[model samples]
Target: MVLLFRNLALLLAILLPQTVQAELVTKYDPVIYDPEVPEIVAIVGTIDARTPLNFSRALEEMPRATEVILASDGGSVLPALTIAREIDRLKLNTTILPDTGCYSACAFLFFAGNERASSGELGVHQISSDSGDLESGQLALSDMMDVLSDYNVPDDVIVDMLRTPPEEMHIYTPEQLATLGIIGTSSSRVAKPTTPTADMSKKDLAAAFVQDFNRLWSLPNAQAVDTLAEKYALTVNYYGKSLTNFAVIEDKRAFAERWPLREYLIEPGSTAINCDELTCRVETIVAWQTSAPERGARSRGRALQSLTLVWNGSGFRISVEDGTVLERQ
Candidate 1:
């Protein structure tokens, strides 16, 4: 009788749903939310072979989600691959949160999602051994190639990617990955309104300025900078000079001091530019003319332009940000 009771207890434990385990674990490792992004389900931690078990539960327990937010450094390849397979099977949308990334093996998971997106800052490279050295083992290379093949990654790309040392494995830019048909269109580049017309009062303008400035500063890409400049009717400093030479800087004061105008040019993220009579802004973007970095045509070009403005009830003020290179200026 005693033996039967013990056996019954063990069976019950084994039959308990994995969802219960997820609930228990989440109490210790909770997912944090970003108010700026309300729709994303943040997955914050190292993703390894062990992650699939918890992820399976997360998927089962969380409400039917349109997208999954993944952020992690590379971990065990086998487990990452498993997670990737599940993401594909589920046809879930995936995205990398800004200032976060899915590196190394974790990148494979990103590619497997039905629709891959990033807020910004998605880095990918190669895997190294536990000893922090390149795995010269034949099996490691073969296994890596197998994993790449599972994702339908081209052999040539795999060869070129692995040609570098593990420490120097090439990272893919969002554009590069998109061109390769890996991650789909990126969502971080969309233009946003700086402020609504209804909130253009003095206190509101100042508050919105600081808020937008901080957020833009966090992801200070040239594209974002350009959008902010256009919405505000501002000018960017290019090589210590004004941006009027390269691009059209709108004359908002001449148009009329107002909150919302009829026509406006903006960059990717929609930031409502306030080109009135009081404050102004501008943008400077340095980019290569060509795709190949070694080619002279690919040399970085400095472009300056006007972006934003504000109505001080007197005259327009232009407050443009500095044109500093985000990478290899």
Candidate 2:
């Protein structure tokens, strides 16, 4: 009778597949990369529920890290807030590299940095709960606001956050971030060439604008492009294509990465300048060579470009730029 009972229990166990629970799995595990600077620790991954613990372990191992470089898409909000709190306690500087992203709850970690620097994407949106309870959502938002307030984030930034929907994100430009007081103006990540004074002659302004534009292509940075965009409403007509300010900046970034600038020269007799009290326009022909060596017997292609600059009250900035390959020998 005991053996019969044991056999019956085994049969029941075999029949009850639904009694077993599946283990929950996280999408990504946090990892620290080799430091570019001795005091900087680079971390990359999703900020899931386990991230805080993982990050804590990383911090424990690299207790001397004074800065953190982050690239993440974000995940569980509670863990993200916990990680942010840890970052604040450590008083570490935070930076995001160009072409990378720190989105959603990841932005909270960025804001927690004592000194924040972002040359890449920093995106934010409204926080929501999976349960879809209105009260829960409100409580979550309130908690987020408290966190931001504790970090001294400006009121305007909070407003922006509130307005952004959970399904969509707002990507902050360096200039916008500075204006919102989220980042310091003098931060290396957002530094750009100074604009020319209003008193300068249109010719001088045009010359300065050209010089800066060339510098932009030589070493492209989003901050510099954003500065130029803010100073003058940029409109580019390139190779029969029309580009807005953001598009122009993105194109320049892509171009710079693909072919680093070796040398650039503006043709002497190819420049024309016109000005009025409210605005000025400069048109010029420029030439450039890339650092990449030529393939086979062909020389590296040289770009001949036509550019236009417009001046508002602030200073001159690129308004239109068109380019074509002038030489490939």
Candidate 3:
């Protein structure tokens, strides 16, 4: 992810001010960490003329990369298409992981995938020109549609993209992708480890994961950095704060020190889990009670938690954690 946002802006200005500006999280280079795609090429930021160069550099360095992961808001569609053809030429799978977003021309990069998957968000809208007449816009739009047809984007999806105004967006979540037959549940789904239905469904697995998270967090040792990092990514969007897993661990440690004793769990029947094959979004209500004898205080409350979890072969790991207090004492 681009932690150096200031540098990213300067880089974009130097590259092409009108077309490329990165509001993305990761990089356009070789990264072999993502569970899928042993050697992964992640293309984020904006797709400018230089995008193809960076992409080529990544592939030249990591020829074994079986997939390209994208999380771009978008940039020039022309350059994006150039990159897409390269991805196709190399026959790379494409994916979008949780907490990331793929939009506008970025959709072309995704559509060109040999095997596509998305656990994040994908958004589309009408083709736009910063300085062009209506006729020009129509011509551009028609050309875009033709190219998307060539890329094998679903007709309905393409229609939705064309219909969305340039200023607005039509967004598709992983669940929507599943409904569109673009994900694991799709008719074109390739072989994957069977999601054990007899033992536990995905929703059930999500609920249990959340419940276990709460159980672990209620412990005095909940702040154990390594333990917390095991469930949550090293980088997390905790509530709204961008925090490292260690920072979050310390935060929990402070809470435990303040409360002394506490119990927390997901409220019964309040779990709502949405999933595709690779990611899950779980929404649930957490009830908590805390006691601080030193202050002679007792507290009870409930909060709604929104969690984004991604599959890592054996189990899920949280990528985003957000909550809203629904009740407090």
Candidate 4:
């Protein structure tokens, strides 16, 4: 009888629902209810097998909610994937509020956000099974990878995930969260003056600046938004329209998602610069190719760009930018 009960207990532990415990707290915009600030549904507590069904019920009760906020240490891996699928199905944004954390299985929920974000802790580690069966653990890992792949998580991040053990977590730093396409959370870049140094001329500054700009622009990273925003003025004559830097960055963010792979080349010998006391005007030809493997889409082009820049004591900021495509494929 003792042996039978002991085996039964072990089996029950293995079969227990793996998920979270938490109430969905809703935050409304106002009595006036602004669509711009969509109502949020907060999920907090232990995650177990029941969380997905609970989430669905909560959504039904709060039909207007468009974002989900998560705070959890972790939960079962499979059910977290189920919740993530539903989040994706509804195109809901996921957030981890400042000071709160979403770790382990919660990372799956965070990434499923149509627009993922977090100011709080977001962490991941290898998936494991309670049964101590290596085969079951391997299957869980495979399933987790498949879900992450569906969400377009970066290959580098996946590598990090694979290497981290179940006992240890890889917590994402704020900059990593932002630059890795996990979040576009506001982060400032401090620009330093290079002109005061006797070793480099203004021409050299401009040349080096162009190289760094092109190199960063070519990366399939989310940091481009911050980098370009740092180099642009509050208002810009961008491509064609007069737009605020904020709007420009938003457009850039969307562009990055649409094309996760890119290559930008400043056509050799095609750059011209004219400078005065506090400003510079530059003209360059750039050839570019961008692709989205998930969507099976590719775009390639060469364009002539004219830019007007103003010195901000530290460096040049683009105030005007005009581009004309010379060729497209």
Tell me the deviation in Å of residue 140 in model 3. Answer: 3.7
**Backbone N/Cα/C clashes per model:** 45, 1, 2, 10
Q: Tell how far residue 191 is off in model 3, in angstroms.
A: 18
For candidate 2, the TM-score is 0.48
**Comparing 2 and 3 on lDDT, the stronger one:** 3
* Per-model TM-score versus the true fold: 0.43, 0.48, 0.46, 0.49
Per-residue alpha-carbon lDDT of candidate 2 for residues 66-177, written as tens digits (9 for 90 to 100): 8777677767777788888988998888887655677888889998898898767788888886468998777777778788867876554565577798778878866567
Question: Sorted on TM-score, highest at the top, how do the candidates line up?
Answer: 4, 2, 3, 1
Candidate 3 per-residue C-alpha lDDT over 159-220 given as tens digits, one digit per residue, 9 for 90 to 100 = 56867887787877676565454554223752222244877788777877788788766755
After superposition, the stretches of candidate 4 with alpha carbons farther than 4 Å from their true spots are: 1-38, 184-329
Give me candidate 1's TM-score against the actual structure: 0.43
Tell me the tens digit of each residue's lDDT in model 4 across 215-296: 7777656556555666678899988899999998888888888898988889889998877877777788989999999999
Better model by TM-score, 1 or 3? 3
Error of 3 at 41 (Å): 0.9
